[model samples]
Target: MTAVPEERVDRFATARQIADAVLLEGYVLYPYRASAAKNRLRWQFGVLVPPGYGRDAAEHSHQRTECLMEPRRGDRLAVELRFLHARRRTVQRAVGSRAFETVEELALADRVLVPWDEGVEERIELTFPVDELAAGEVVRAVRLAAGEEQETVQEDGRPVGRLLRRHEQVDAVLRLSVQEVPGPYGTLRLTAVVENTSDWRPPAGAGRDAALARSLVSAHLLLGLERGRFLSATDPPEWAREAAAECRNEHTWPVLAGGDGRADVLLSSPIILEDHPQVAPESPGELYDATEIDEILALRTAALTDREKREARGTDPRAGAVIDLADSMPPEVLERLHGAVRALRDVTGAPADPADGQPWWDPGGDPGVDPDRDRVQVGEHSVGAGSRVLLKPGRRRTDAQDLFLHGRTALVEAVLHDVDGSVHLAVTIEGDPGADLWRAQGRFRYFQPDEVEPLEEP
Candidate 1:
């Protein structure tokens, strides 16, 4: 996840923190009520619906991740496939001494019941020697046992309704294999593939709800190495760039993780991430809604009326947890969640303290940099704002639309530097009616230094 491994063990707690965040992402949203429309449309990330079920191209029945790793003799790799199993909770009202009739809601003296979908965490771990994966493909069977449970709903100790909860038997397959290829240097490139092969089919004209019942929700893999190191697939070194590019990943994204930048662990996630991403330290536990900030949601949730709070608590146990967390969190904790900063540095590239100088985000942090007067050297000529250039659209760096700009003249609007130290020239098409407007709005097409040809002065 060598590049990402087995379900998370204690050693991978850091990665597990992020993994848990991903697992519960969007499990529930703000208002946290069953009646809320947003609460019903859930499970957005890493959901693999039953094989061939939905028309949405973005949602798939299976996914694969390919990454590069370097293994030594006797290297052992571990992989943990993590996902959520969805269970249906039906609220039933007692009609007879031994029988109950299904109902929409059940009211008791202390609590209210609403029918909702609940998630059960599922993890399957497999460990193997690197040679074993490379010599022959490894396929592990994934199964979530089908089960049912009944929770008696009582008002003052008298049975009023029953909560019937059950989950479908879901089956899936995890395949791990590898290919050996030569790297840009004398080193070797070990490309690994992780895939999902499930054997579930939806009945005639089934909807997403039906397919999702037997699907793997928020599925991801955590990878670890005992005697090997993994390389960054997204930003490989100059030597391994070509080899890394050769890896074809589908739907899934993998990134280096854990241990002070050591490549021993990788997280192959359905969501895109930079290498070594972590859950924010300021985060106050799971909100189930990743899109919104914790502090804001905390305040809003704490503000809900007593009646609204009751409904939220009854919606799902998770929402109840969120409510409890928000209501009981200390002021110090809430203050910590207000903001966070990372990679702070000045224009001189010197580390700066956020507590001291002007914020790094503000233009006054350092006066050394200015897009308006800054100039970049291109082919013996100094180019800056107002300079002219012809779009060359280099084969290596050009996008699909870049081809249409081929041979077109453009006016440089700014010379920008990215965090990665790459220089890009922002420009607008020459003589376009809206060029001035776009320039005023600071919106323009960007191209690398190599993708443009300097236009000689007339």
Candidate 2:
């Protein structure tokens, strides 16, 4: 057999090609959102085929194949929707009147666009016959209502009365069909139409390309980080954090200011609260974009060879995917963690009854009490839902190298206690199927609720 190619060879080209490929597998469409105002209208559509194309593949499997579309204020509107299957020959319609709340509902009956992946360019003529005189007029009127004005000079040399011109809405009936065709480069198609129900010539020079350009630019700029579905901003990657930091200098700090000591506060500048969400962009459209970058990274990372992994271990060791650390450790272990976290999330909310209040569960009173309740603060580090921490043997055991006994890390999944106050934890660990791998169990104790102490690995 022929030798395989080196993983690091053409890394940049490979990444870019893969990125383009990923871009193709997904699409971005500007579906019409019906205007709340009568006669208000905006419409456009575009499709991109991600790098990989397959009948059985899931659209969501590769995060790169995601798209986002949102309407801006104006008579203009934009709505984004995802299409899983694009290769098959199909025609879908969307329609709407004044009563419809969204332009998407209208596209269901009035507009139809085809999606393709081939690099070849194609177009079709859509014949929307408005046989009835009044209905056709109404259609033309609606189309024109969404139009703007243009000025023209009269032959007499004086400026003529400016005419109300409909923006060249690409009222093309047929669109680029790339789904079935394969090409050298990936495929991107933008289709628009201004069908006339009335006996009037379709608006002249209405360009869908301009609108598509605006949509694309807005998509890239407005949705820089709001792309991944599984993406989170509470604790984002370094790149995202840096990008968001550019927006403002203020940072969040949890504070306890009152002399009475009962009042505690988690405070941040308003800018942080408002802009932090942009980093993750939890909406479907933004999530898809973030996921796309992640998917491309995963693909490129997967392409790494054993040698490459070993060599790169010094600088860029892979995170090896997120481990549900809580699931691996025992139930009793989880109980302790949960109780710790629950106590933390509710620290300030605890009732005023000193006997039943803040340090009630502290057992050791103020000296051992931790006022913060959102996360388990151990010394300098904090633990929470998404925290990834390593558990090592404490006090009773000794070993030069920490053993990967469970083939993974011990995560704090939850903390629990019985009616008798005997604490138990529900822990999560990675199970090894080959070795008949299963969850491991262990117990933990927090000498003081406020102070972070290393657990004795059992």
The candidate that achieves the highest TM-score relative to the unseen native structure: 1
**What do the candidate models score in CA lDDT, each in turn?**
0.80, 0.24
Write one digit per residue (lDDT tens) for candidate 1, span 1-458. Answer: 22433333544777877888878888889989898989778898888876666577777777787778887778888787889998999999998777899988876543467899899998777778887887877777776778999998877778877999999888788878877767533333443343335466667887777777888899888888786778898788887788888777777788888767778888888888889987787888889887788889899999998777788888888888888998899999999988878788446765466668544443444476688788988878888988999988887767888888889999998888764567889999997899989978989999987888889763
Looking at model 2, residue 429 earns an lDDT score of: 41
lDDT of 2 at 426: 34
The total of clashing pairs for model 1 equals: 17
Candidate 2 residue spans exceeding 4 A from truth: 1-289, 292-436, 441-458
RMSD of each: 8.7, 26.8
For model 2, residues 9-79, the per-residue Cα lDDT tens digits are 22222222222222322232111111212112211112221212122222111111111111111211111
User: How many pairs collide in each candidate, listed in order?
Assistant: 17, 80
TM-score of 2: 0.18
